[model samples]
Target chain A: MTPSREQKLWMYEKMLVSRRFEEAIETIYLEGKKPVFNMAKGPIPGEMHLSNGQEPCAVGVCAHLEPSDVVTATHRPHHQAIAKGIDLKRMAAEIFGKATGLSGGRGGHMHLFDPAVNFACSGIIAQGMGPAVGAALSRKMQGKPGVAIAYIGEGAVNQGAFHEALNLAAVWKLPVVFVVEDNAWGISVSKAASTAVPENHVRAEAYGMPGHLVRDNDPYEIFATAGKAIAAARNGEGPSLIEIETMRLAGHFMGDAETYRPKGEKDGLTLRDPISRMRARLIADGDADEATLDRIEEAAQAEVDEAIAFARNSPDPDPADALTSVFV
Target chain B: MTNTNPARANERKLTIARAMAEATAQQMRLDPTVFVMGEDIGEFGGIYGNTRGLIAEFGAERVRDTPISETAFIGAAVGAAQDGMRPIVELMFVDFFGVCFDAIYNLMAKNTYFAGGSFRVPMVLMTSTGGGYSDGGQHSQCVYGTFAHLPGMKVVAPSNAYDAKGLMTAAIRDDNPVVFMYHKGLQGMGWLGTVPGATNHVPEESYTVEIGKAAIARPGKDVTIVSLGIGVHQALEAAKRVAEHGIDAEVVDLRSLVPLDRETIRASVAKTGRLIVVDEDYHSYGVSGEVIASVVEHDLSVLKAAPVRIAYPDVPIPFARVMEQFCLPNADKIVAAIETMLGRQTVGEPS
Candidate 1:
C-alpha cells in the first residue's frame, strides 16, 4: 500500500531529527563537553556503538508505534530515544549524569530510561531482549495492542539470551518485534567474520518465526518492513525478526581510530545515508521539497542545540543518590 | 454418619512431605494466579515427592514441568513473575542455583527497583539442601547463606514440618523474590530425637508465618545455640543432652535468614552471655560468622566466652559417608561446641 504524502514527510522528518541529534552529541564529545568519566572520549580506549549510520532503523520502526508501546535498545540508543519522542532535554540530562535526567541521573547514556515514553535502555550486551519479551508478554496478558520493540545490533544476535528469548517469545506468541540493525559490524568484527551464515534473519528459522531483510539506509523500506512485522505481532501472529543492512558513517565514537574498518568505509556510506535518502525520496516523490527539507533540518538542529544547553545547565546527581536506586 | 468424620480426623497424622503438599495446594487454591513450574514437579511429583498429587489437583496448566535447564526455566520464572504471576520455581538442588544466579540476583531481585519500583516480581524458589544420603558436593551443599547476603533477596530455611508448611506459604505470598531451602536431611525423619510424647503435628488448615522472624524452640539459661534449617534439630538434641548435664541450653531456630531476628539473638545472648552458632554450611563468611559478628559488635559484654561456631570446614563436601558425617555438624558436635564455649570441658562425654 502506498503511504500518504503526510506520512512520508513525517518519516523523513523523524529520520532527520535522529541523525542531527546524534551528530550534535558527536560534536559535544569532540568539544570535551561530555561526561568527565566518558571512557569512549579522548584517548581512552572503549567503543561507543554510535547510531551514526543506522538512524533510519529506529526512526522507521518507531514511526508506527504509539507512546504506549514500549521499546528496549542497546548502548547505541540516542536515535531510538529521539524517534520515540522522549524529551530531548531529559535524555541529554541523563547522558550527562544530571539530576534532571530521565533515570534521575542513575542511568548514563546506555542505561537511559523514560518510562513515561515506554523506553528502557540497557548497557548489557543482549539483556534488553528479556525486558522486551517481558513487556510484550504483559501487553498480551492485558489484552492490549501494545507491541514491544527490541532494537539490537547485529552483534547481539550472538548472545545466548537473544536466542533463548526469541524462542520463548515464539512459543508464547508474545507481541514483540526484534529489529536487528545489521550495520555490517559487531564492534571491530564484521558480521561475516563472526557468524557462519552472516545472515542474522536466518536464525529466526530456529525459533520457527519469519525473518525479513531490508535496505537499512532507506527509511521508506525499513518503515514498510517493520510495519508489517509489528502489525503481525499486534494481531497475535507471534514475533518476527527483521535484519536491515546499512553502513556506519561515523567512527564508532567521537575519538575512535576506526583501525579495523576499511579506511573509507565510514565516509563512503555517506552517499546513501538514511536521513538524506529519505529527504530526497520525499522531495522527488512530490511529498516535500528542498525548502521543506531545509526547514526540517534547521528545526532538528535547533532542538538538539537546546537539549545541549539544558544538559550543560542541569545539576549533577546527589552523591547520596548512588545508594538509593540500588534497592528501592 | 458424622461420627466417622471425627474418628478419621483423629487418625490423620501429617508427614513433612504431606504438610508441604498441603501448603502448596492451599496457596495455589487461594490464588488462581499461583503456579508451580520445574523439572519433574508435575505428574512425577518433585524428586522428593513433596509436590505429589498437586498436578492432579491443579491440572497440567498450573503445575507445569520443564526440561533440565535451570537457567531457562528460572529465567522464565523471573519473566512470569514480572508479568504478575506468582511462580514457585523449584531448582532441584540448592547447589544448582549457580547455573541461574543472574536470573535470581541481577534480574528477579533487582528488576523492580531498577525499573524504579514500577514493577514487583513475586516469586518463590524452592530447592533441597544439606547432606546425609551422600548426594556428594555438587548436589548437597547448603547455599541459602549466599542468597541471604544479597540485598533484595529474602532467604528462609525452615527446620520442621510446621515451619516448612508455614514458611513455604509465606514465600509464595511475598512481594519480593524468596529462596526457600528445605533440608534433605530433616524431611522424612518422622519424630526422631523428640522428647517421649511431644507431638510433631501440623493442623490440616494452612497458614503462613512472617519472614525474618526467629522462633524459640527451646529456652534455657547457660548458652544460646543459634541455628537454622537442618541445624535446628541438631541444636535441640544437643540442648537435651546439656540438660542431662544439669546445664540448661537455649535453642533459637532462625526460620528466616535475611530479616534475621537480630533482636531475638541479642536478647538471648544478653540472658545467656554466650553463643554457639551451629551452621550447616562452610565456616568462612557463613551465616554463623555473620551472627557472631552481629552479636560481638552489639553486645560484647553479654558474651561470657568468645562466640564460637560449630560449622563444616571450608571445603567442598566429600562423597564418602564418613567424610560427609565429619564435614557436617551433628547433635553430639553441637553439644561439644556448647560445652567448650561455656568452659564446661566435658558435658556430653561422661568423665
Candidate 2:
C-alpha cells in the first residue's frame, strides 16, 4: 500500500519531533533548568538508554500503526510514546512524576501508558512481551486486525518471558510483532556478554519462527522490516521477531560511566546516527529544506518548553492515592 | 443439617474435569465477556480435558490456546481485564507457577493501586493443584498457599464438584483477580449424580458461593475441623471415623482462602474449644497458619488444645509415592490429630 506523500511527511515530521524532544530534554537536563518540576529531568545517575541516535525505528513502525493499535514498549520508549501521539505535556509530566502525568505520576520514564492511545509502557526488562502478546490476543478475540508491537532491547532476549511469549504467539498465531532493539549493549555489558549468539534475531529461529536484522540507523529499513513483520502477524501468520541493530549515543542511562563503552565509540556512532540520516535525506531530497527543518525544531522546542512549564506548575500525586485502585 | 445436599447422600458423582468444563461453558453463556486461554485448551481439550468441547462450543476466539508461556498469557489476562473482558487462564499445573507468579502478585494483584485508582483487573486464574497421582514433584504441588500469602488475591480451593462449579462461577463473575485451585483428587468425589437418583446428575445450572463464606459440613460440639481443598474430604472422612470413637467432631469447609471465613471458625471454635486445621499446603505459611492465626487473634479464649494444625512437612515434595504419602495429610492423620487433641493417644505417637 502506497501511503500518501502527506502521510509520509507527517511520519517524518513526528519522527523529527520525537528526536528534537529528546535533544531538547538533554539540553534542559544538562543546563540544570530541568523540565521535571521535581528537581528532575532526563535519566537518573546510572544509565538512561537515550533514543537520540535511534529515532527511525520508532518513526517507521509507528507510521504504519493507527492510534487504536495497541503498543507495548520497553524502558527506552520515549520515541515510541511520542510517536504514538501521547501528549508531550503529560509525558513530560509523567517523567517528572507530576500529578498531571499519563500514569497519574506513578510511572516515571520506563512505565509510560496512555490506554486511550493503545500504548502500555513498562520499565521492567523483557516484561513487555507478555502484555504485548496479551494485547494481541485480545485484539484477535475482538476480531480486530490490531497488531501489537513489543519494542524490546537486545538485553531482554535472555529473559525467560521473551522466549515464552514468542513460543505462545507462534503456537496461537497471535497478532503480535516482537521488535528487539539490539543496540549491542545491555547497560555496560555488551550483547556478547548476554547471549551466546550476538545476533539476537537468530534466537527467534529456535521457536520455529523467522528472525532477521534491520539496519537500526536507517528509518526506511526499519519501516520495511517492521511493516513486513506486522503485516504477517495481522494477516494471521502468527508472530515474527525483528532484531534492530543500532548504537546508544548516550550512556546506558544519563550520567552513566562510559568506561564500558570504548572511548570515542558513542561519538563515532553519533556520526552515523539515525536522526541525522533522516534529516539529511529529507533535505537532500528536497522533501523539506533548512527553513522548514528550522520551523519544525522551533515548534518542537515551543511544545517541549510548554510541557516543562506545565510539569513544573503541576502538583505531585497525593499520598492517599497510594491506597486507591487496589481492586476494581 | 447445613441444608440439603444430594451429593452427600452418595447418590451422585461427576469428574472434576466435567465439572470445570460445565462451569466454563455456563460462564461464557451467561456473560458475553468471559473467555478461556491456556496451553492446548483449544484443539487438544486441555491437558486434562477439562476444557473439552469448549473450543467447539464457543469457537477458537473464546476457548483459545496459547504457547507454553504462562507469564505472557497470564499477564495478558491482566491487560485484557483492564479493558473489560473476563478471562480464565489455565496454568495446567501449579508447578508452572514460577513462570507466571509475578503477573498474579505484582501486576494483577496491585494494578488498581498502582494505577492510582484509575484501573482494576478482573480476571480468574484456574489451575490444577495437589499431589496424589504420580505426576512427579514438579507437576504435583499445592501453591495456593503462596497465593494466599499475597494480599488483594482471592484464592478458592473447592473440594468437590458442587463447590467446584459454584466457586468457579463466582470467581468468573468476580470483579478482582481470583485464583481457583482445583484438587485432582476431589473432581468426582462430591456430586455423585447429575439429578436426584439419576446417578449422573451434577447441576447443569449455575450458582455462586459468595467469597468469605464457609459451609459447615457437619455439626458437633466436641471439635471443629477447619479444612479446605482436598483436605476437606479428608476431614470429612476423619469425622465419620471419629464418630465411631464417640467423638463428635464438627467440620467447617473453608472454600475460599483469602477472604477467610473467620466468623465460622470463631463460632465453631467457640463451641468446640478445640480446633484442627488441615491443609494440603506445607506447615509454614500455608492456609493452615492463616486459619490458626485468625482463630488465635480473634477468639483466643476458644482454644482448648493449642490449635492443632495438620499439614505437610516443610520440604520440596518428593517424587516417590510413599514419600508423597508421608508428606501429605490424609484422613487417618486428621482423625489421629483429633484424638490427640481430645486427650486420647493417636497413631504415629508413642505413649
Candidate 3:
C-alpha cells in the first residue's frame, strides 16, 4: 500500500530516532573507551550490538503491530525496541544501568523488557522465537486479535529454536510473523559460509508457510511485505517468514575490529544506507521536503539527547537490593 | 436404605496420575486463561494418563497436543505466561530437557529476575521422571536436583496422590516458573507396578500443598530418614523394617526441593541424632549431599554421627533390570545404611 505524506513523515521520524539513539550510544561507548578501555568502565557497561543500518527492518514490521501485539527480539534489539514503542527514557536508563531503567537496572542492553508494550528481547540466539510462538498461542487461545512478531538475525535462522518455533507455529496455526534481519554476517562468519541455504526464506516452505525475501534496504518494500504477512497472520492464515536483506554499517559489537570484513566493504556499504535512501525517495516523490526531513532529524537528535540526560540523572540501584526479584 | 457415605463423599482414593489430572482440570475450569499443551496430551490423554479426559472436557483448543518440540512449547508457555495466560507445558520426560535447557533456564527461569521483577512467568512445566520398569537411562532420571540448582525455577516432586493434587494446584497458581516432576513409578498405573501408598486418599475439593514444605510420613526418635518422591515410600518401608529391630526411624518426605524445609530436617535430626538421605539421583553433588550440608550448616553438633546417604552411584542408569535395581536406592539399601550408621550389622546386598 502507498503510504500517505503523513505516514512517510512518521516513518522517517521513527527511523531517525533509532539512528540518532544508536549514534548517541556509540559516542558514549567510545568516550568510555578513551584513556583505558575496560568494558566495565563504560556508561553502557556491557557488550553493545548496535543496529546502525537496520532501522528499516524494525520500523517496517513493527509499524503494522498495535501496542497490544507482542514482539520479541534478539540481542541487537535497540532498533526493534524503539520501533515497538518502548519508552526511550526507560530503555536509555536500562542501558545506562540506572534505578529507573526498564528492568530497574537488572537487565542491561541485551535484555530489555516492557510488559506494558508486550516487548521482550533475549541474548541467546533465536531464543525469542519460542516465546513469540507462545505469545501467539496465548492470543489464539484467548481469542485475542493480537499477533506476535519474533525478530532474529540471519545467522540465528540456523539455530534449533528457529526451526522448532516455525514448525510449532505452522502446525498450531499460531499468529506469529518471524522476521529475519539478514545483514549477511553471524558476527564474523558470512551467512553463505554458515547457513545451510543461501536464502533463509526457502526454509519456510519446508514448514508449509509462505516465505518472502525483501531485498535491499528499502523501508517501503519492507513495509509492504511485512504488512501483508502481518495481516495474513492476524486473519488466522498461520505464520509467515520474511527475510529483509540489509547491511551492517558498523562492527557487530562496538569494539569489534571487523578484520573479517573485506577491504573497502565498510566504505562501499555507505552508498546503500536505508535512512539516506528513504529520505531521497521521500523528497523525490514529493511525499516530504528536505526541510521537513531535516527538521525530523533535528527533533530525533533532541529527543535522544533528552533520553541520555534522563538516564544520566537517574540514580543507581541499591547494592543491597541485588538479592531481590529472584522470584515472584 | 438411603446411602449415607460421608467418608467416600468427602474424599476418594485417587492414583497420582488421576489426582494430577483432576487438579489440572479444575484449574483449567476455574481459570479461562489456563491451558495445557504437550505431546500426546490431548486426544491420547498423555502417555502416563496424567492428562486423561482433559481434551474431551476442555476441547482441543485448551488441551493441545504438540509435536515433539520441547523448546518451542516450553518457550511458548513462558511467553504466554508473560502475556497473562497461565500455561502448563509438558515435557514427556525430564531427560528430554537437554534439547530445551536454554529456553527453560535462560528464559523461563531467569526472565523475571532479569526483567527486574517487572515480569512474572506463571507457568508449570510438568514432566515425568524416575525409572523402575527398565525405561533405561534416557527415560528414567529424577533430575530435580539439576532444576533446583538453577536459580529461577521452583522444583516440586510429590510423593503421593494427596501431594500430587495439592502440589499441581500450587504450581499452577504460583507466579514463578515451576518444574512439576512426577515420578513414573509412583504414578500407580496398573500396567506399571506402583510403589506402596503411591495412590492415597485425595480430597474432593481443590487444595494446595505448600511448595516449600516437608511432610513427616512416619515419626520416630532413633534416626531421621530424609527422602522424596519414590524415595519417601522406600524410606517408610525401611522405617518399618528398622522398627522391627527396635530401631525407631523417622521418614521426612521433602515435597519441594528448592524451598527445602531445612528447619524440619534440623528439628528431626536434633531429636534423632542420626540422619540418612535416600535419593534416586546421582550420589555426588546432589540432593543427598545438599541435605548433609544443610544439616551441618544449621547445627553440626546435633548430629550424633556422620550422616549416611543411600543414593544412586555416579553413573548413567543401566538398561539391564538387575544392574538398574542395583544402582537405584531401595528400601533394603536404606535399611542397610541405617544399620551401618547405627553401628550394627548391615543387611544383604541390594538384589
Candidate 4:
C-alpha cells in the first residue's frame, strides 16, 4: 500500500527526529571524552551505541504501532525508543545517569525501559525476543488488542534464544512481529561472516511464519510490510517476520575505531543516509517543500536540545539510594 | 505437644506434589492473570506431578505445555510478568538451569532493579530439585544455593506438603521473581519414594506461609539443626537418632533462602550454644557455610562449641547409587557430624 502524503511527511519527521536525537547523543558523548586518553571519565558514562543510520526501521515500524503496543529493542535502541514515543527528556536523563532518569539512574544507555509506552531494551543479544514473545503471549491470553514488536540485529539471529523464541511464538500463535534490522555488522563482525544464511527473514519460514524482506533504507517499504505483519498479528493470525536491510553510518559504539571495515567504506555511507534520502524525497514528491523539511529538522534539533538541557539540570542520584529499588 | 489446641478435622493429608498443584490452582482461581507453563505440564501433569490436574481445570491456555525451550519460555515469562501477568513457568529440573541461566539470573532476577523499580517481574520459576533415586549429576541437584547467591531473586524450598502449598501461594502472590524449588524426592510420588512426613496434613483453603520465616520442626535445647527441603527430613531423623543419647537437637527448617530467616537461626543458636547446618548442596561457599557465617558474623560468643556442617563434599554427584548416597547429606552424616561436634564417638566411619 502506498503511503499518503501526510503519512510520508510524518515518517519523514520521525526519521529526522530519531536521527537528530542520536546525533545529539553522539555530541554529548564526545564532550565527555575531554582527556581523549581516558574514555571512562565522562558525563555520559559507559558505552553508547548510537542508531545513527538505522532510523528508517524504527520510524517505519513504530509509525504503525499504538502507544499500548509493546516494543523490545536491542542495545542500540535510541532511534526505536524515540519512534516508540518514550519521553525524550527522561531518556536523556537516563543516559546521563541522573536521578530523574527513566530508571532513576540505575539503568544506563544499554537498559532503557519506558513502561509508559511499554518499551524495553536489553544489552544481551537476542534477549529481547523472549520478552517480546511473552508480552505477545500476555496480550493474547488477556484478549487485548495490542501486539508486541521485537527488534533484533542480524547478528542476533544466530543466538539460540532467537530461534527458540520464534518457534515458541509460532507454536503458541502469539501476537508478535519480529523485526530484524540487518545493519550488516554485529559490532565488528559482518553479517556475511557470522550468519549462515544470506538473508534473515527466510529463517522465519522454519518456524512456519510469513517472512518479508525490505531492501535499502526505504521507510515506505518498511511501513507497508510492517503494517501488514502487525495487522496480521493483532488479528490473531499469529506472528510474522520482517527483515529491513540498513546500514550503520557510525561506529558500533562511541570511540570505536571500526578498524574491521575496509578503508573508506564509511566515506560513502552518507550517500545512503535514510534521513537525507527521505528529506530529499519528501521535497521532490511535493509531499513537503524544502522549507517545511527544514522546519522539521529545526524542530527535531530544538527538541533534542531541550532534552539535553533537562538532563544536564537533573540531579545526580544519591549514593544512599543505591540500596533502594532492588525490590517492589 | 507444645500447644493444647486440637488439629482441625478438615485438614487433609496431601503429598508435596498435590499440595503444590492445589496452591497453583487456588492462585490461578483467585487471579485470572496467573497461569502455568512448562514442558509436559499440560497433558502429562508435570514430570514430578507438581502441576497435576491443572490443565484439566484451567484448560490448555492457562496450564500451557511449552516446548523444550527453557531460555525462551523463562524469558517469555519474565516478559509476561513485566506486562502485568503473574506467570508460573517451570524449568522441569533445576539442574537444567545451565541452559537458561542467563534469562533467570540476568533478566528475571535483575530486571526490576535494573529498570529502577519501574518494572516488576512477578513470575515464579518452579523447578524440581534434589536427588536420592540416582538421577545423576545432570538430572539431580539442589541448586537453591546458587540461586540465593544472586542479588535479586527470592529463593524458597519447602520441606513438607504444608509449606509447599503455603510457599507456592506466597510465591505466586509475590511482586518479585521467586525461585520456588521443590525436591523431587519429597513430592511423595508413589513412583519416587517419599520421606517420613513428606505427605503431611495441609489445610484445604489457600494461605501463604511468610517467605522469610523459619519453622522449628522439632524444637529442643541442644544443637540447632538448620536445614531445608529434603535436608529438613534428614535433620529431623538425625535429631531423633541422637535424642536416644540425650542430645536435644532443635531442627530449624529454613523455608526461604534469600531474605533468609537469620533472626530465627541466630535466636536458636544463642539458646542452644551450638549449631550444625545440614545442606544437600556442596560444602564450600554454600548454604551450610552461609549459615555458619551468619552466627559468626552476628555473635561469636553464642557458640560454646565450634559449629559444624554436614553437606555434600565439593564434587559432582556421581551416577552410582553407592557413590551418590556417599556424597549426599543424610541422617547418618548429620548424626555423625553432631556426635563429632560434641566430642562423642562418631558413627558409621565419618561419612
Assess candidate 3 and give its TM-score to the true structure: 0.97
- Cα lDDT tens digits, model 4, B255-292, are 89988999999999999999999898888989999999
Chain B: TM-scores of all predictions: 0.92, 0.91, 0.95, 0.95
Q: Alpha-carbon interface RMSD of model 4?
A: 0.6
True contacts kept of 4: 0.78
What is the lDDT for A316 in model 2? 82
Task: Give one digit per residue, the lDDT tens place, for model 3 in B299-319.
Answer: 999999999999889899999
User: For every candidate, how close is chain A to the native chain A in TM-score?
Assistant: 0.93, 0.90, 0.98, 0.98
TM-score of 4: 0.97
Candidate 1 reference-contact recovery: 0.12
Model 2 C-alpha lDDT per residue in residues A206-317, reported as the tens digit of each score: 8888897886466677777778887888788888998888767777776566798877787779788766676677788777888977787677778777877787688887
Ranking by TM-score: 4, 3, 1, 2
On residues B1-351, what C-alpha lDDT tens digit does candidate 1 reach at each position?
000011234544555566678889999999976888788999988876678899999997778776565655676676567656788889888898877776678777776555545456788988888876677799889876688888777889877777778888888888888888877766663432222112246767877777888988788999999999778878888888888878898888888897788988888989999899998888998799999987998968888888889888899999998999988888888878877777675465522
Using TM-score as the measure, the top candidate is: 4
- Candidate 2 C-alpha error for residue B17, in Å: 2.6
* Ranking according to DockQ, highest score first: 4, 3, 2, 1
Model 3 regions more than 4 Å off: B1-11, B346-351
Residue B48, model 1: Cα distance from true site in angstroms: 3.8
DockQ of each: 0.29, 0.42, 0.85, 0.86
Minimal lDDT window, size 10, model 4 chain A: A32-41
